[model samples]
Target: MNFNPVEILGLIAAVFTTSAFLPQVYKTWRSRSAKNLSLTMYLVFFTGVMMWMVYGFLIDSLAVILANIVTGFLTLILIYFKIRYKD
Candidate 1:
């Protein structure tokens, strides 16, 4: 209810970070090609995102929780596509 500058900044940052993955997600989904993606990098990143979500919960950070949840789902989809389309 109270306005917090830090929380506002966090939400703004979350928007940018979460949206950064949209291009890759769209490309992979539309082309069904993930040959250029790194499975290891995604796995690590997803794990980190999940951890960030947990950390967000522990800290009661709504922006972090929401952003990571969406990001994690997108990352998981990429991971799935990577495995499914592997040559």
Candidate 2:
């Protein structure tokens, strides 16, 4: 688990970006409303994230893989909420 400076920077960036969705997920879950969320956008974003994950695996990048895995999970939750809380 030896990370170079660049990888460390990447992990930092990944932490920020991946955690960014927490508030939205919490809000959606607590409020039980996703009428304002765009399903199409999330679907597209999820697809992109999946691609990034694949790229990460191919490149053997830990930061990208970890970040996308968490992001993908959060995105899935948002998608589920969007469908379940559809108004």
Candidate 3:
């Protein structure tokens, strides 16, 4: 297998940024506090992710498609928890 530098960077960035949400998710699950979270931000974030997904579709970029797909779900779950357990 061969790794291009840019692709490696993309993969690294994708992993780091995507994994950033894990702690938030775990903490939220443990404490069930959504007050500090922003509803409007998540709504806009979800919309932006959806748009990224669509843009990926239009451009046919695998990296863009994959990252956005995973991030989108992660974001959606947080949003759901935010709604379900808002303070």
> How accurate locally, in lDDT, is each candidate?
0.90, 0.95, 0.82
User: On residues 1-87, what C-alpha lDDT tens digit does candidate 2 reach at each position?
Assistant: 449998899899999999999999999999999999999999999999999999988887889999999999999999999999878
The estimated TM-scores of all candidates read 0.89, 0.95, 0.86
Question: Over the stretch 15-86, how does candidate 1's per-residue lDDT look in tens digits?
Answer: 898898999988998998999999999999999999999999998998889889989998998999999988
Candidate 1, residue 51: Cα displacement in angstroms equals 0.9
Model 1 alpha-carbon miss at residue 65, Å: 1.1
Steric overlap count per candidate: 0, 0, 0
**Clashing pairs in model 3?**
none
Off by over 4 Å in 2: none
Give the CA lDDT, 0 to 100, for residue 73 in model 3. Answer: 90
Task: Name the best candidate (by lDDT).
Answer: 2
Clashing residue pairs in candidate 2 (N, C-alpha, C atoms within 3 angstroms): none
- How far does residue 74 in candidate 1 sit from its true spot (Å)? 0.6
Ranking according to lDDT, highest score first: 2, 1, 3
* Per-residue error (Å), model 2, residue 62: 0.5
Residue 64 shift from truth in candidate 1, angstroms: 1.4
RMSD of each: 1.5, 1.1, 2.3
Give the alpha carbon lDDT tens digit for every residue of 1-87 in model 3: 235687677768778878888898888888999889998998999899889878867876666667788888989889999999958
